[model samples]
Target: MTTATAIVAGHGLALRRSLPLPNPPGRPTTVSLSARSLPHARRRTIVPVSPSPRRPCRCRSISSESSTAASAASDTVEEDAEPAETYDEDEDEELDPQAEVCYLDPDADPEAIREWELDFCSRPILDARGKKVWELVVCDATLSLQFTRYFPNNAINSVTLRDALASVPEALGVPLPDRVRFFRSQMQTIITRACGELGLKAVPSRRCVSLLLWLDERYEAVYSRHPGFQAGTRPLLALDNPFPTTLPENLVGDKWAFVQLPFSAVREEVESLERRYAFGAGLDLDLLGFELDDSTLVPGVAVESSRAKPLAAWMNGLEICAMEVDTGRGSLILSAGVSTRYIYSGYEKTPAATQEAEAWEAAKKACGGLHFLAIQENLNSDGCVGFWLLLDLPPPPV
Candidate 1:
């Protein structure tokens, strides 16, 4: 399988030609060896590097179902007829005096704090009672504030977890976060209950980048040093992912193509997208420590959907995780949230698909496992309703 790389001049993209590239049957080819010969080319700015780090992408156009229910419930509450009087108290009285909090960035502004990533689960260490030790780790998105506490397995519960969460604000002088995100779907029941008791919105998502990185560091530096640390124990229990399911019949696209764009072009165009609804992880290469050049090609899938708005809205509710080419199944798999897997499309059993998949994977690896999913009205659409920049980071060291 011969492959050739061609530059798309004004558009700021590099096309890698693998024979019979991943495109729907009978669609006009979007990639060409000569950029000047391509139809409808557009110009874009090329930035060597972004000045300030891009913010993490969030679905902001619509609130989740859980949040809507919470909002409705709050509306029924009545205000007090009389205002309560304040009482003077000693300033020295400490809240959870025993709690020890660690700040990743001591100078991080409290006003900037909004969301928190939390992990409450059993560690690889045992207590004197020979029971597994449980831990509660919390951090903001910016790696500014981190709080960790350990508990015995027997004492781990929603009540204990709530108290630990409450103590964070008192210990760090930061306000309670509006929302808390966790990656473990298995711990959903307890984590959700604990957050609910304190009126904090709980989100189950795979976007806990900072927390995962912190866990990796702690596994090597803190947990390993414990006298009761169990060697060879996995940091996180492995959960079986559901088999890949098909996308909804109504949401399937009319056509799709595998494409690549320069990092600068992606940043410029995605940010300037003119659409009624758009959501995705913004460019945050700096946070991930990726050092690719502006011209580096980033692979992505472009879907032309007549029902683009509805499809994008539905996907916004999910934690869009990663994409993979499953050679054994001969399918393109989209992994979302914790364990939900979807068969985005299937590939022919021919060598072209294998070659294209290899090239896509190679490009993703070169760009630090970063790729994108774009949903637009058509191939000629100026903007997409949804453009997710996803990172397929490796699981933290077990």
Candidate 2:
């Protein structure tokens, strides 16, 4: 198969040819979207470069789910410094597409769907061709406002945490404030470029700021006025987060450090995940927690739903503990949960299965579409078919 590059150079992309291009590997290529970086993306200029397809075509929309992060990381030297020599195996794995880029699935082209309109909603639509059929895949959002991994910093940089703040730019001679600003700016660029490459809209700056400030301790002042932390110190009148009960006790430190989650912004994103062929939510929604003086969170979240017992942020004024607190000395709790749903799609009268396409659709409906984590299918001892619909949230970020 041959491939070609279709760089998106401006606010809107113009079709060079009216022909189908190879799908961007994982997402929908049904429509054409303008390819522009976020406004701030122009500053630090950490544009994410997407993989090009081999077909001859203009700037048609394409899907390159795996390309988002790699593309962004590929162009940077600064981002290279913070992460340790090794990346967590989980994060190292190819991320869920919808969990990464925002997509608008209209069965039309740019001529039908206007640009600004792309700002609002997009859905998965099915159209039939004479003899071909394919489904769209998920990609990371440009702003990641809907993306969950960045928040809840549960996926800790073991190397950076080992030395407390070593990842901070200040450790390298740059002023604390300036360095934080620079990183934030770059994050904005990554989000925008990530979205652009995948044929998604840019992540808004406001959402970007929330993620940036939440990740960088230097900007906690921007936290919402009513985080509703159950035991948070600021009298009920204060806006910041309260102390969470899930944290382990006095292993010891005065600082309250739990992963931060911009749920208000990401909930919608999580709800928009794709279910066909199997995908999970915001990669297990980022759950928030407190930071220990010596221990650190790995930078991820635990999403909890019905099947799993949900822990309240505060249990009657007392902090609720998430249980584990000792992970070889250098770990913080950042757990997200996912409720996975699997449908039995098979054929064998000896067993009752949902029957291929019907079972698949049933599974999609039974599962939370884009927000599932745990799933199971079993044939009862009596040979009766049984399906287990479960909610799987990752262990509180470890």
Candidate 3:
């Protein structure tokens, strides 16, 4: 048996290296990011690829000013610039605050600190006054920093949430997160407003894997042992995922294909080139505690469109949750941001499409629901407008 070590590099590209199996598969040796160096870790030089001369229509930068005229003019000039260079420049502006804070504390590495995951909802326990107790739980993606506080149900509002969030930096001795992710849709309005007031991007996403795991642990180990704990209470947070909606007419892909890449190829071919828009930092298999063989197949879907840049930008704004084959609807469904869903493509009764979908589902299952989605101008294109490594996690227990 052989295992692979996964590393998330430059702007969330997933990189891996095959290693001789030391421990049993699925039991990964704990590797700390704080370590100065690992004997097994090797550096790979990134050979920059020049932007294609025949560039597709560019998408307006999402981080830029809102004026349409200004955005259009900027997009025209950016068409000739390297996508990676443009992204790096924008990112530096966003990280200036974090960088400044890290300078004051040499021990704190801003790159190693993941976004904060927060949950503010009613708990299964009650206070002495007979009022239901609500709790706020905050934890970083790595689960290294945590803050928990309880309040009466009546006190659950934006003001209370805001004050609690404001204290997180000092309480946990970490810089404010660029974004805060919460899984509950019912609390979206309050959470969004609270984060907005504090200049934090509040994302409604099911990608709060670390926070969910912590909540489950506390439910069984801490909540259940409390005297005020209510027995057999319903789950605190449940999302009513709606049916898949059709993709916007203009954004629909002209061609699509089911694809697969081995772990070795992902590290070699995919990681070598920088992507225009990439989002996979939260889906690291090693951080999520999975160790698989280098030959493991990573199933995915490729979409091609003339408006590849715009399509990629639109998808990047959404918290990409998962992609699945909806056999009943005969369509490929993409789940994103809280309970939002989109029909990626329709297979109908086509034999070839159905078979390909089946193969993709099988391969994805074999790899523990790990897959990706790539947006490119065409199948033969060397560069991708967007690439996302997504995980299809099981629904929360009722």
Candidate 4:
């Protein structure tokens, strides 16, 4: 019998059947996104490599004004911008229930999976140690911008965020500063509208599974409207390796232990504990360098509990890393420490992209393989880093 998995929907956590199921095939469309709303929204963004949860290879920027949160939003719209469609808050008609729901089946696999490279930092415009990143957090059916406080001194702006905008060349011929301003405004509006459409809760870690999907679609919509978004060279949306651990054996270990931003001292303490566990388990973990990149898993989002509550209630039980060096590079990085079990760590590091990918295949040979890991080095977009991996593991927990 298949083990039951928990998925967050219908307001809270709901238990559902778990299996490697692909999304039901849908009709092909000439354009990327088929809008359910936002009449003026564009939908021609480039998704170079999207390893969607159910939609193969389909996948998911952050910057700020004073807080990476721009002070003044530009009234200027995209050159091809259509008049904003009015949202009818007073409408009594029922909302579309089946509208663009991003279901993250943790048991599913992705096609065209590749190792996400961390090269954007090297770009003169993107070079940085710890830039402020943010994400949209929904709790109790409301938006939360609590994390904005972390960047009280929001003097610094993210280069990639600005450059990605620059890639568009300009937002409606507006100055770059104005473009950033509008970008923040539009992002907030877009995400707010998205939560209502998808019915996601305003809680920590719960929205992780679906937030990226919405952004990925939004990226295309905005890009299609842009004048010079080329077909090649990175996309606006970034995604974590669809499968973080792939082992032949199906071993569903404990629920995710924790996911949150930690101070350096705390991180070091955790690392020390993790190392002892790995060595004692005889996993003989390799000493890989750690990432200090502060870019969030969902850049530009500010997730926190409601004003009355704090993060302590739900910070644990989630698997996330905010300070890892690679966090800023592409999409989220889901690390499972070095290894969960010595027996599963049988595969040696291999060269050549395709061949090395087989390591995940080797791992799945065991049961409940959710926490398995393959090693990779820090990478630039053009080339793979030293022994760096293009990974495939089980889907991220909802």
Q: Which candidate, 1 or 3, would have the higher lDDT against the true structure?
A: 1
lDDT tens digits, residue span 230-342, model 3: 76666556665798776766556655555555554444434533543443333534334334445455667777778788877787878887888776656678888888898
- lDDT values, one for every candidate: 0.62, 0.20, 0.58, 0.21
Off by over 4 Å in 1: 1-101, 104-106, 269-277
lDDT of 1: 0.62
List candidate 2 stretches off by more than 4 Å: 1-141, 144-210, 213-243, 246-273, 277-280, 283-398
Is 1 or 2 the stronger prediction by TM-score? 1
Question: Against the correct fold, how does model 2 do in TM-score?
Answer: 0.17
Q: Which ten residues in a row have the lowest lDDT in candidate 2?
A: 337-346
lDDT of 2 at 370: 16
What is the Cα-based TM-score of model 1?
A: 0.74
Clashing pairs in 1: 57-282
The TM-scores of all predictions, comma-separated, are 0.74, 0.17, 0.67, 0.20
lDDT of the structure predicted as candidate 4: 0.21
Clashes of each: 1, 69, 0, 54
Give me the displacement of residue 169 in model 1, in angstroms.
1.2
- How do all the candidates rank in terms of lDDT, highest first? 1, 3, 4, 2
